[model samples]
Target chain A: MTRVHDMGGRFGDGPVDPSPEPVFKEDWHARALAVTLAAGALGQWNLDTSRHARERLSPKDYARFSYYEKWISALADLLEENGVVTRDELMAGQGAGPSPLSGRKLRADAVAGALARGGPADRPVDSAPKFAPGDVVRTRRPARNAFVAGGHTRLPSYAAGAVGRILHHHGAHVLPDANAHGRGESPEHLYTVVFDAAELWGAPERAGDEVTCDLWQSYLEPA
Target chain B: MPHDHHDHDHAHAVLPPDPALRVKAIETILTQKGLIDPAALDEIIDTYENRIGPKNGALVVARAWTDPAFRAALLEDATAVVAELGFYGRQGEHIVAVENTPEQHNMVVCTLCSCYPWPLLGIPPGWYKSDAYRARAVREPRKVLAEFGVTLPGDTRVRVWDSTAELRYLVIPMRPEGTDGLNEDDLIPWVTRDSMIGTGLPGRPE
Candidate 1:
């Protein structure tokens, strides 16, 4: 539940390195991204599943993996899980026999159009939003069992259980928690919750500093 | 080529990192399986590597600096306004442009993941994805901004936006003083990727 990937508010990691570099440094990084995007376009697994696959890796390995390495590993895991390819096939870099295609290949010519027309997750719901701007709310501190079973959540560990004010109601959107696990869309009211630094961390930090996060309604309750 | 056991060490030394090799291996296998098209892969890479980048976002920022109407439209509906300028896509689908005033400053981070507006900012920088930045940005934002050589006045209110949903954020950094005469084209260079991300301020004219 409290995985190594969820590194928020913890200390002693060291200073942030502010260096500039190209998006993809090595040739493999670009290839990894390309392969991941291609496989993802197949509609076999959702983004959440891919993310969970990476999180499921051993903490040691997860820590060791670069950004694209994580993506490739997850892609490999998903391919094996979906029976698209075998572990041996992945290892050998060649299939033993002909495999069925996904039939949903993103052609090169359509790349620009596809990117410009991005997927909008907002969905209409039957009910009115529970919270509104200026409403006081407390983030639900997820139970240990729930956290373990939920797979992934949009609620970060640092924001959980903290009290904050709703700065704005962002309308209903697909809940990532359910969408990640192939449960359902389960759209909910999203809010911009603003937490004072003193409220999240402690006093004596900066009095005027605040952290604002877009939190789904399910993750909050009236304070 | 014949398999040679004695050259394994030399082969390993010559090969790239294990991750890179593994990715190449997977790509090869997927291509053989006909699940992935190499041309499509190149197309996707080229789009992000060339077609999309901070320059697109810089144009948006520069317009906001020179034109009050465009700035108002951007702050009100960033998605449509940015799309009007041809910067809308995957992560940039839903954007909320927060303006940095003299009294208040804005910063952005994704504690859960590196969720950035790719169409606006291109691929996120390395530090933005680092554990240190993710963990400390919200806790010690002043310190974090200071490390980036951005020293805000202690009296200014620092607002850190943690992107937890599909709505991506972009900081409409305050227009630097003494730039009233500059046109939108001239102001583009002053706007940096870090400024839009709120890690650093826009470059000042020397």
Candidate 2:
């Protein structure tokens, strides 16, 4: 059985220092330590509490990997279990070996298996598009400190109630998630949302400056 | 699917990478004797800082302090307009200037991820992305600032801006009046990198 979890070692509760000053000077050891810590945060995805979450993973791997390494590991595990790839193949250092998996037409099932196996080179197109360019939108502000369900969303806590306009639409990208329900997420449109200074800071009384931001699809709803 | 069991209101899409040429490029770079190292340094580079980090922001901030109107434009749409000064580059894309005024002060955070104005500021300082900084920066910004040795008057509201991929931030520190006739080129020295990051304000002539 895979190890379910470890205490996340240290630094789990929060930052060790509440008032730690920004180190203006560069330090390699600090960067190494930070990169190591970042790996741990990503590792927690394996132990996610959702029903759709993945099972016990190797603690050794968890403790030693980088952020990207963790992502590659989780993805590799999911794909193998789903018959997307064979153990020998992955270990043999053979990639999913360039598409067209056994002459199967690329579609929902194939793409799904490929994603589980690894991922399709070109991401599948999203069927449902919530908002379009020039749409007036408001990012939903859920009650603070409440744990919402599902994927790792790009929506920031501070931007919850903020309103803005959709400037441009960027096609779908990865939905950083591990929940079972979220496993099927496909590429969707990303929007560049522009907000006026007044709306965010209650009118920049002096210069009346404006601020704009880029937001992924899931973060907005029609105002 | 009318009365859905799940909230389909939000959807997720995972875009796979192009494994062909991209990986080859990454592999070549990684295999290079002394190119880029998440660990070791390439001899050609003194430290990663000069090649890609804070020095970039420091240069811009230094220039802004010297030039008043340019500083004004930078405070405006830093991403779109700052190019006029020939300081445009990759990392500073979508820059927004947060002003630290007598009435209020401003700071920045990338709570969700380490999104920063890399072109202008260079690489983000490690502490900026710490969980401690993320949680405390907003809840107790005044306290956080004080720790950085920036004690603000109670009257000044310290605003904290969280940077995301969609937007980046730069800080507009108050100009020190003592350096009255200093031209833009001469004024660059006073605008330290920290001032742009909103950690410390520019010091007045001693």
> In every candidate, how many clashes are there?
0, 14
Model 1 lDDT per residue over B1-206, tens place: 11122322222222234887778877787777677789988988898888888898889999999999999998889999988788888888889999999899999998877889998988888899888998889888888888899999878899999998899998999998889899999999999999999999998745
Task: Give candidate 2 misplaced runs (Cα > 4 Å).
Answer: A1-149, A157-223, B1-47, B84-91, B204-206
Q: How high is the lDDT of residue A207 in model 1?
A: 92
The per-model DockQ list reads: 0.42, 0.09
Each candidate structure's TM-score, on Cα atoms with residue i matched to residue i, is 0.93, 0.52
Fraction of the true interface contacts (Cα pairs closer than 8 Å across chains) found in each model: 0.69, 0.06
Which 10 consecutive positions of candidate 1 chain A have the poorest summed lDDT? Answer: A142-151
Q: Whole-model Cα lDDT per candidate? A: 0.81, 0.47
User: Which segments of candidate 1 are over 4 A away from where they belong?
Assistant: A143-150, B1-17
Candidate 2 DockQ, CA atoms: 0.09
Q: How large is the interface RMSD of each prediction?
A: 7.0, 14.2
lDDT string, candidate 2, A1-223, tens digits = 0121212111233542434333334233333322222222222222122212221234444345433334344444443444444454444334434332323322222222221222211245736567777889997674121223433345554456788888655455444332223354444555667665456545342233333445656667788
